[model samples]
Target: MYYPTIRGCIQALKNLEIWLDKAEQHAAAKGFDVGVLLTSRLAPEPSSIS
Candidate 1:
């Protein structure tokens, strides 16, 4: 049980790293700052969430 949970967490971290790298490459291709993507949120504002 614990093994599977730990494995899942590690896998998720690895996937996040891959996604961040891709986002950086995409930002460079579009000539925008990678920080823009890094700092972006799923919602326009945190207060908007209920």
Candidate 2:
């Protein structure tokens, strides 16, 4: 059970990195600053879980 949980966590992190890289590329292709994209968030407020 713990092994599957750990694997899932690792996979989630890898997926996040992949998404960030894609965002960076998309920003560059659109002639926008990657920093702007990086700083922008989908959430208007901070999460309690973090």
Candidate 3:
């Protein structure tokens, strides 16, 4: 199986961060903890190629 390159992984993480930031802001306005609902990949996980 072909895995994502470092650049691709970086891009995916960046996009995830943006979405997570938005969700966090929304949750904060409602008095909720974002961390409880979100998890960040400090390192990438294995992905199966289809």
Candidate 4:
């Protein structure tokens, strides 16, 4: 039971690594800084109430 869960987590991490590699390749091809990809956010920052 736990083995499958652990395997899934490892697979997800591997997939993330592959995606990051692809992102780096894309940045190189586009002549952009890899930091741009590293610093990007998927969700908008929460606004503070005044």
Top lDDT prediction, candidate number: 4
Point out the worst 10-residue segment of candidate 1 by lDDT: 41-50
lDDT of 2 at 1: 100
TM for every model, in the order presented, reads 0.76, 0.72, 0.53, 0.79
Better of 2 and 4 by TM-score: 4
Candidate 1 regions off by >4 Å?
46-50
**Residues 1-50 of candidate 1: C-alpha lDDT, one tens digit per residue:** 99999999999999999999999999999999999987988777767765
Candidate order by lDDT, highest to lowest? 4, 1, 2, 3
Error of 3 at 28 (Å): 1.0
* Candidate 1, residue 10: how far the Cα is off, in Å: 0.6
- Candidate 2 TM-score versus the reference: 0.72
Tell me, by TM-score, which candidate is best.
4
lDDT tens digits, residue span 1-50, model 3:
23558778889999999998899898899897887566655546656332
lDDT (Cα, 0-100) at 5 in candidate 2: 100
Which runs in model 3 stand beyond 4 Å of their true positions? 1-4, 39-50
Error of 1 at 20 (Å): 0.3
Q: Comparing 2 and 4 by lDDT, which wins?
A: 4
* lDDT tens digits by residue: candidate 2, 1-46: 9999999999999999999999999998999999998788777666
